[model samples]
Target: MSVVKPLPNYLVQRYRGWKATTYDNNKAWYRHLSNEGQHPRAMIISCCDSRVHVTAIFGADSGEFFIHRNIANLVPPYEPDGGRHGTSAAVEYAVTALKVAHIVVVGHSSCGGVKGCHDMCSGHAPALEEPTSFVGRWMDVLRPGYERVKDIEDEAERVRALEYEAVKTSIDNLMTFPFVKESVESDLLTLHGLWNNIAEGALEQLDPKTGSFVPV
Candidate 1:
């Protein structure tokens, strides 16, 4: 016999009139949403950090954006292959199925993935089993970040550079998709890069001119 685990009662739980009360407040639109499928206008690639939830940060409804999460928000360098590309697949579906017009890559500071890249760049990785440790693989994916930031002198500056480069690299990878590239060429889709700092609660956007993330 399988033991049943207790489930969260978020559906009914109330805290300062936040939960069920919220549902009650949005009942009319929620009811309509239940009857129809999602139609999001933007696609966001966010880090897999729980504290950096995309929808919550943006106050988005269930169907407002197509979101994909990954370590460091890394988008693998494009491979022109018939092989399955998980990130590519999501991008294709977002632009094709959801008809999203904007794609955003969101990065954050104090990132474990960015930390991994920092450790690797500083020659300080912890012991790993070689053939396959997720951290090792993720660090490998962040080589481009290191390449962009390694020459910097200050430690803090290096981390900041990695944070921004990682976001740009993901955007670059998004352009690899034929659909994304074509849409961009046709001026039907736009790309954006965003950075969030957890400690300071600061948000910085990539300055397309200098490729650095600046406040607001």
Candidate 2:
């Protein structure tokens, strides 16, 4: 027997409300989208943190962006070893298939994954170091980023620096893919790194020229 359960009452109510209002009001537009298919302009790689609302951040409507969310928003270096790579697969489809013009790696403040990476790298979280921990293996992608910010004396500042490094590191890893590199060199695609201050509602974008993050 299956153990699946239905949605909670609140979510059911919310869905009904949206179906009755928003969906009803935009029936034609929704039908048009269904018929025409999605043609998003950019691909956004963002952290899985619930607080980071990718669409709301840019006030983007449906089908405006191809978004992928993962822990710490870290992208591993291109490894054609034939392993199960969800993030890489998404990138491949977005770039080679969808042909998105831009790819953005977004990191944010108060990221639990980033914090776990920091803790594990600092030898403060032993459980994450275990071989059985999936999160530990996933966070290994950010080890380089942690190395860059490990020496910072202040704990808060160090974590924040690591967050920014996470974005930069992911962008670097993204360029490792042959298609990504080709698209970038040919000027067919652009790469961007962004860091969001969750509490302050502020965003900082990486300035490639200076290799620094500045207000967007």
Candidate 3:
């Protein structure tokens, strides 16, 4: 028998409520999207943190943005070694198939994945260093970012800096893909990096010229 369980009561009730209200009100739009298909303007790659609501933050409607969420919003260098690469696949589809004009990497403050990476890199979390640990292997993508920020004296500040590096690192890695690099060089696509301060509701955007994050 299939082991997948039904959604919990709260989520079921919430879905019903949404269907009754929001879905009901937007039936025409939903139908149009279903029939015509989605033609989103941008692709947003963000951390899988529950607190970072990508759609809500930008007030984006359904089919407005193609989004992919992963731990620390990381993008690994292009390695076409016949490996199972979910993030890379998503990016490939977005750029090649969907033809998205912009690709945004969104990182957030107080990200658990970023914290875990920080701890692991600093030698405070030995468990994450184990070869068998899936999270450890995944977080290895951010080690270079951690190396850049390891010298920061303050613990909180260092973690925060690492968070920014995560965004920068992903953007840098994105260019490693030949398709992405070609599109960028042809001026057909653009890249953006953003960091959101969860509590303060503040957003900072990366300035490509200065390599700094400034308030948006």
Candidate 4:
């Protein structure tokens, strides 16, 4: 037996409702999208938090953005060692193949991944420090950011700083990819760092000139 399981009844019913209501109402748009390949102008890399709705946030339609979601939305440094790199692969395809002009790394408040990094660094989460910890290994990319804010005395403030740092870290890592670097140098692509306030629904954008984030 394949051991595959079908979706739960609730989810199946929800899908059917969406297909009937939303898809049916936009049949022509959906058919047009099916016939024409997607050419999204921007690629958004965001955290896997369920509350962060990329489409709803931007009021975007079906194919306006190429969005990739992962824990803490961290992007690792480019390492062409022939290893498996899912995030890097998505970035590569979005930049080189899809030719997206804008690459946005959006981090947010109350990020579990950032909390894990803080815990691991503060000696609170020993399990995450273990060599076999997949999350810890993935979070290693943000370890440097944690180090920058580790000395902050306030716990809440420290976590928030790491969240912002995580966005900046991913933006920095994105530049390590040759395609991204070249495109940026040639003024073909631009990188953006964003932090969202989950509670207030406010967004802050990074200002490279001042090296600080300001409300958008």
- Provide the lowest-lDDT 10-residue window in model 2: 1-10
TM-score for all models, in order of appearance: 0.86, 0.98, 0.98, 0.97
Better of 1 and 2 by lDDT: 2
Task: Supply the TM-score for candidate 1.
Answer: 0.86
Candidate 4 weakest ten by summed lDDT: 50-59
Query: For model 4, how does the per-residue alpha-carbon lDDT over 14-80 read when each residue is reduced to its tens digit?
Result: 9999999999999999998889989999999999999888788789999899999999999999999
lDDT by residue (tens digit), candidate 3, 81-193: 99999999999999999999999999999999999999999899999999999888999999999999999999999999999999999999999999999999999999999
What lDDT does model 1 reach?
0.81
**Ranking of predictions according to lDDT:** 3, 2, 4, 1
- Per-residue lDDT, model 1, residue 201, is 76
**Candidates' C-alpha lDDT:** 0.81, 0.95, 0.97, 0.95
